[model samples]
Target: LVSEEELARVEARLRSINQFAPVMHCTHSSVSVDQVLNIHGFDLQRALKASPELLNTSAAPTKHDARVSSVSLDQSAPRHLRTVQKGELDLDLLQEWIGELLNNSGEDIFRMKGVLAVAHAGKRFVYHAVHMTFNGCFDEPWDDEARESKLVFIGK
Candidate 1:
């Protein structure tokens, strides 16, 4: 069960996204939503070709900066797509897929700021990271479109 503090933290984070404050691990990176959509479209196509399970995910334009959008695990995608990749033999072969992403894609990796869905301790987790360092994860899963994981990375 999510404690009141945890819920409040999540709500606060969601509410304050547009404030441009100094969030740990994430910078107030700036970019257009179209850029994010293009990145998602290209990278996810690659991810899908490498592992079909990713077809279960979706990328939608969020109301953040006109240039801010997000990638989410679609409700119809296989449950395995929601699992974090930690190893090769895992149910959906996701570990290999993520490794490929990290190894082959550098140009598309603008800046690493945003929320991530991480699976740990036998439950789904959500995390917000900025600049790839300041990070925090919650033990609950996000099942709604409004609460989906979002990250904004600006290219240098």
Candidate 2:
């Protein structure tokens, strides 16, 4: 476990580079595994429940400046795009399009995530990508909720 003073210093450094950096959560052996997992897991449902703003697909795209190093790092800010569509999508075509996007601009794309309504499927498709690596899987059944696709991209 990091000392409180050290943690504060690290957070300060991170905020200096990117003001929007999320708060750091530290865990130790004393913490239960389930609790730690809940805190650090990449579960989108948990995230959406915590921050409903992520579902606000109608909001305008925004950009934020990020600077790592004064000498070598690119000073350009990252841009965000949120897309919302109300139709079922072809899984094969969507995969192909995502592949093409990664092929064309993977380096500039920091992260991409979406919940998709796939044609002929009862469950929602959850997709996530970081740089050139991506994965998708069928999630919980849509049940009675409206089938809508929402995608968010954060990149240069």
> Which candidate has the highest TM-score of all?
2
TM-score of each: 0.26, 0.53
Please state the error at residue 8 of candidate 1 in Å. Answer: 36
Q: Pick the candidate with the highest lDDT.
A: 2
Per-residue lDDT tens digits of candidate 1, residues 1-156?
Answer: 567797679768865752322223223656555545544334555555765664454744345454443454343346676533322123234335444544565344444443444433333333333333333444554555333333344432
Q: Roughly what TM-score does model 2 have, to 2 decimal places?
A: 0.53
On a 0 to 100 scale, what is the lDDT of residue 139 in model 1?
Answer: 57
Task: Please report, as a residue range, the 10-residue window in candidate 1 with the lowest summed lDDT.
Answer: 18-27
Lowest lDDT block of 10, candidate 2? 68-77
lDDT of 1 at 54: 47
Full-model lDDT for every candidate:
0.44, 0.74
lDDT of 1 at 102: 41
Candidate 2 per-residue lDDT, tens place, 37-116, comes to 54553666766676667779887656646731112111122323222335788999999999999999888888888788
